[model samples]
Target: MIDFRYFLVSIAAIFLALAVGVALGAGPLKGELDQQLRGTISAVSKEKDGLRKQIADLQEGDKYRDSFAADIAPDLVKGRLNGQKVVVVALPDADNGVVKGVEQSLTSAGATVTGTVSMTDKWSDPSQRQFLEELATRLVTGDVRMPDNGSAYDRAGVVLARALVTRDAAAAGRKDSATPTIMGAFGEGDLVNSDSDLPQADLAVVVAPPVQAKAKPTPDSDANQAWVSLARSLDSASRGAVVVGDPSAAGDGGVLASLRADKQARGAVSSVDVADLASGQVATVWALAEQATGGVGQYGAVGTTDGALPKRPTAGS
Candidate 1:
């Protein structure tokens, strides 16, 4: 609808404006613009260097703390769990190093670690539900009673707990007569792996897997809930039980996180979310001792309403 001349004039005006802007950038405004750009770059460089130094200092501080905790760990946990028999239960994907560290810590606390029971991936596999339920039903003996109504894992927890742990101090460190048969069934079924000579323990420590950054399972997912059920059942069946994991395991979708979010589970079992560290290892010992004395707490770097560690017991307590 516009005239041809007007269109041409508008185009020419635009080009002229661009030319003027280019001239100013190349000539009159060039020095000021370059100075401002250099100033911005210099400020950014300074900030980056400052941030790097701060991060380095923080890292060094963390290293020092970890070293100190490791050095003092033995004395901190010494005799805390004396005369207690503890079992280490390694969940699927559990870190071997963490499990070993936990066992060593328990030993340092004067507790005898009966053995380690490592759960297979099939322990929580959906397809194994029927097998687990049937096995648990078959394993229920006069000494071990299955819940009237519960998930397959929940019932399996009862059977497993009865085989591995006992609340009676008189029976501690001695295997039940049916332990061999029960554990053999689970082993043959690919539900768990354990030493052949495992004795019944008075307390239990469940080592969970570290958190995954991607594709993390939901807190209420069946697998996680099944694990929670097992842990709670262990606590109910044993003298005491504590679940330990790395700090990342306290994050969303992590087993420790999921357990903490569960009201009933958190109320029954203790947990430590920094089991990968020396401090958390000491905390695990303290938590177990606390459990022996009828106390329950959640400890470590996250959701620790009970504080970083349980109260240290008095000498000879």
Candidate 2:
């Protein structure tokens, strides 16, 4: 309804307002805007530098802690195991350094290191579960009772535990069933090999690494249950069992992570969650010593550990 002239006038007014705003920004606000930008850049730089320094400081502290733990570890673990015999079992992805450290810690504590057992990654694979079940069924003897747990891994674990460990003192004298035939079968399958004389060790230290997170958890995601079953079976079979692991193993998918969480197993075996550290290694030694006396506790930096170490083993225990 308006004339064309009125439309043009409105457009002109809009342009005029824009021009004034530009002029004011360039003429008056330019210095303030530049100063604000400079201040923001400086503040960002300071924050970045502070973060870098903090990271460096944390790294330094870690080095100091490791050194301190190493220095005192030998003294702390000395004579703790006196005359005990121990077998070392390395699970898949286990740290070689931690395994060596565990042996050192145990040896320092006066325990005999019979040898080491290295388990293949395939040992934990769900695909091979049927094979393990078949093997377990074949190996299970008249005296050995298969566990009622539905998991094939659990069934195998119990069968293997019965074959490997001398649970009964009276059975220790037997000639045929006393020796573990499962070791020979394991060697045949190439699932595990050990230097341990098929060792009838009085104590077992099952070493497992941290459980890494790669995908969203599904039913297949939690292989740590296998470890839990094995540790429980091992604990029942041996005089004592101490399942030691890295922090990750105590994390989301961890096996020993639930050692404290599972009320049924908590009182029967010992566990240490920080096996990578000297403090953790020392704790493991004390845990083994503690277990020898029929007492059990969890110790570590992660899930379910009571403290950094278990109560000191009593004299002559």
Candidate 3:
């Protein structure tokens, strides 16, 4: 009996030793396993971001230039606006006939031309011309392939939508819909206020340079900070449309930043490079903008909702 008891104690000791060995082996392996899991999660996150960007581009079909473009589509396609002022911007001698032609078509449809301002520098300024050339290159190589000669259509669609919304609102009785007219400046420093009472505007058009087409379109750190400051000074919901002839022109970076930052501001936005944009493309952009605001003509629901402009301003003040 004594011998059996001693043998049983020995067996229990051996089992305890084996248990300790198993725990020691598992500790290092557990850490390695945890590290592997973290790596996998990081990789998956990056892949998801890439996929989402691709999906967004596909969904937008060249309209992803900004967010407001997405919000104001309905009114542009319906031709809900006419008789409102549309502002256009570019160099004085840009030969941007496409931009003017599209605007005219909208006016013919019923929009009022409020103002047109051109930059003094057309081709003589090296910095400005460089900007245009670069912008043209980007248009050709970037996702927004400027239709060799049909760019006016795109320009027309975007502008037309904003005009329609502005005019429709003014006609509907939004007393605040009107704004003081202003021209695009190299750095206009917050030109218009969304809340100001003014000359009874049906719409506001801001013609300017494209600020995001440079080999390094982004401005330096100091410029970037100043641009943000300028954006904060403006009304949060300024409704307007943009027509860009060159993306690399001076002061364009600041403009793009401010407009993009004020994402929810009540407005429509579009751009065209007169130097590179084909006639049809510009027309299409303006037409789309007009249709979103319910201006004159109709565009198929490529980017609009319910095919209706923003509720026309309350009927008659």
Candidate 4:
């Protein structure tokens, strides 16, 4: 609305300022600005390189530790569980490598692995609760007493535990007439899978799924609690039972984490939360041996009030 000359002058002034800035950048300030930018890039690159080296060092350290643990694992657990019959139960998504490592560790400790029982996803599906309840009721033998009050999974746990473990040494490693029937029923129901007949064991190792980075941490979800109920039932029915999982399994929503949070279950069940590592496998075997003697502890890198490993029992005592 004002004079056209004033608007033109204002535009010219802005352009002049920009021209001056460009000249400075290309001339007097050019070297300084370039030097500053180069310095910044160099500093950032150095930091990145430093971080990479640190990560490499950590990885190498871990590799060395795992190697050392594997070498000494046999001696560490030698005769610890001599003559004990142990069973491995793999929860859904359980790491096969870890399960195999645990089996080797148990063998090194002189415990006979009866068989590996793999739980299907149906075990944790809420929709299958009614079916599981019916199955448990139908398959429960007279000798196996059902819990008066608990979830359907609890009843199923009792039935499954009765078939897989026993406190009596004579009964262990010996399948009774009902053993195959019970296992077969669960297998047919698509709740459990086993490669061969699973003899009753003196102790049990329940392998939980490894830590899932993307999974929402639902520590108290019905599915997770179902597993907890099952584990508790197994512990009650067996000589002792230990739940093993990877380190993150002790984080939020992990089955091992849920077990640790439960006051009653934690009191009865021993947990090892680093089963993915050789050291953790060794700890798992030791935890089972501890269980054989009425000891309960949570051992691992995370969520563990107990020490890294149970106290190694002295000879014959």
Give the whole-model CA lDDT for all candidates, comma-separated: 0.89, 0.77, 0.38, 0.89
Question: Please, what are the lDDT tens digits per residue for candidate 2 over residues 1-317?
Answer: 99999999999999999999898779898889889999999999999999999999999999999999999988888888887777788888788999999999898888877668887766678889889888778877777777775578778777766655655533432334434477777667776776323556667899987676884233225366677777888788778889998887777667676556667777787889899999999999988888777878888887445898988775335
lDDT of 3: 0.38
In Å, residue 115's CA in model 4 sits off its true spot by: 0.3
Which scores higher on lDDT, 2 or 3?
2
Model 4 lDDT, residue 189, Cα:
92
**Model 3 alpha-carbon miss at residue 39, Å:** 54
Clashes found in each candidate (C-alpha, N, C closer than 3 A): 0, 1, 70, 0
lDDT, candidate 3, 1-317, per-residue tens: 56998999999999999988778658867788778999999999999999999998887965554345434433442343444444443333334554565555445435555444433432223334344334334323122223245222222222222222333444522332212212111223221213222223343333333444433344433333222222221111223344333333324443433334334321334323332233323344454354344332211222222222222332111
Ranking by TM-score: 1, 4, 2, 3
lDDT of 4 by residue, 152-217 (tens): 989999999988999897788898677788898999999999853678898999999876787755
lDDT of 1 by residue, 182-222 (tens): 89999999899986558999899999999778788887777
List TM-scores for all candidates, in order.
0.93, 0.83, 0.32, 0.93
- Give the lDDT ranking, best first: 1, 4, 2, 3
